[model samples]
Target: MVFVVFIVAAIITFAAATKLSTYADALSRLSGLGSLLIGTFLLAVATALPEVTTTVTAVFLDNPDMAVGNILGSNHFNLLILAVFDIIYRKRKMLAHIYKQQRYTALFGVFMTLVIALAIFMRLDIPILTIGIDALIIVALYLLSLWIIQRTPVPEQEKNHSSQEEEYSLKHALMGFIIMAIIIFISGTALTLSGDQIALITGLGSSFVGSFLIAGSTSLPEVVTVLTAMRLNNENLAAASIYGSNLFNMLLLVVCDLIYRGPILQSISLSHAVTAIFLLINSSLVCYAMFARKNRRFYTWPSLVMILFYILTMVWLYYSS
Candidate 1:
């Protein structure tokens, strides 16, 4: 029964997510908002909203580790999606086509991840008001990343999308996108509950469920959105969606911290820091892909290494937990 609910909720959420990329593209065209900004901020907020809901719920349930695990685990999974992009467009690397702003976004991910890892070890999450001081720092950095991304210049081709013949008027696109986003949020909540129940019945530990199963459940929308964007040949939107979602998930930790009574980071098992390490490693791999600009005939070492490390990290986390 739990599995059944998981499948139904996932299908519903993913179906809406598929259209999410389309509506987002239409919104970009009709409104002339660059795909970079739309994907990074707008589409990003849409896809990552589920994490906000689920993480806070986890904290309220006295599962702060699960909440942290979901954020860091989703961060790793989002980067894994980036590696998939590399394989999808192998002849010409995925990084080759995207705007330079992505490097900044990727760097922001790395910096934030480092903060998370260090916070766990240092226990710097001193309670300031309701939230921790560390959480406050993360919130501030996320805002700065947004401001910088907003100011970055988009390519003329992306800027000129408004000139193309459009299917959705700005009004219709806005309505459709809002409606789909609401569906995603509702179904995603269902998915999270069902997934948690399944994990319980199967006796998968909370950390495992949070890092692997629950994180995957929450990321289903991102998967569908990125795949649809690929089919549309919208590389910029596709890449930005993953990077943007990654960034949003990091910021989400601050929210989770706020909801918990104590410092959320200090309360969770240090096992979660294992997940954070994988995030830092994988995010650095992404930056390397962007900065190195090396392309092979079929695949690159960084992409391959990312997948390998991800699998290894999951196994390590399982045993450690």
Candidate 2:
């Protein structure tokens, strides 16, 4: 029964995500926001609604481990999106042609993941009005990342699409984005419940369920958006969407912390540090590959290592936790 519900919810989420990506792209072009900005802020946030909704639900249920795991897990799962893209891309390496903003965005992701890991390790008991210092820092740093990325100019070639006459009205696009978001919220909430049930029935633990199962399920929109962007031959948007979605996933933890009474970071199983460490490693590798322009034959080496690391971390989490 749980499996059936999970599958149904996943299907709905995917269908909603397909439409959401279309409207998000239209909104970006029509609103004069450009793909990078819109991908980072608008599209990214919309796609991340699943993670946001799922994490909020977990926290409200007093499952901080699952809440934090979903964020960290989602961050790493997003990196794996690059690996999938690499496998399908027949052209040269995917990351080699990405814009400079994407490179910087990956760097910022690594830095923020590191900050989160440190907080978990330190397990600070102190909280100002029930919010940990780390939670505040994560939120502040996320805003700074957005500001920097927005200010960093995208290549003129990339702006060509935005200059053309819009295909959809601002009202239509906004409405589409909203309607799809609501669908995602409902499906995502269902996914969270099913994930918890699966974890309980199988003894996989919330950390494992959140990091691998829930995170991957919530990230379905990202998969669709990336594939769509790549098919359109819009590599920049594809790359930007991944990094941007990751940024929003990190912020979901802040929402969890605010809702989870007490220091959310310190309260969850420190075993989560395992997932966080893997996240830092994966994000750093992505930054290196992007900056170095390493385009290996078949697929990028960094992406291969990324998949391997994620699998190993999952194994470690399963047994150790």
The pairs that clash in candidate 1 are none
Runs in model 1 lying further than 4 Å from the true structure: 294-299
TM-score of each: 0.95, 0.94
- lDDT by residue (1-321, candidate 2, tens digit) is 999999899999999888777787787677766777878777888888889878998898888989989998888889998776875683657788777777767887888898899998988666776787877887888889888877877567766777667767899999988999889888999999988899889998999999989999999989998888777677777787889889888887777777777778888898899889988999998888877775455346778889999998899888876
Q: Best TM-score goes to which candidate?
A: 1
**Cα lDDT computed for each candidate against the true fold:** 0.81, 0.83
lDDT per residue (tens digit) for residues 229-284 in model 1: 88887878888888889888888877777666777888888888777887789889
Query: TM-score for model 2?
Result: 0.94
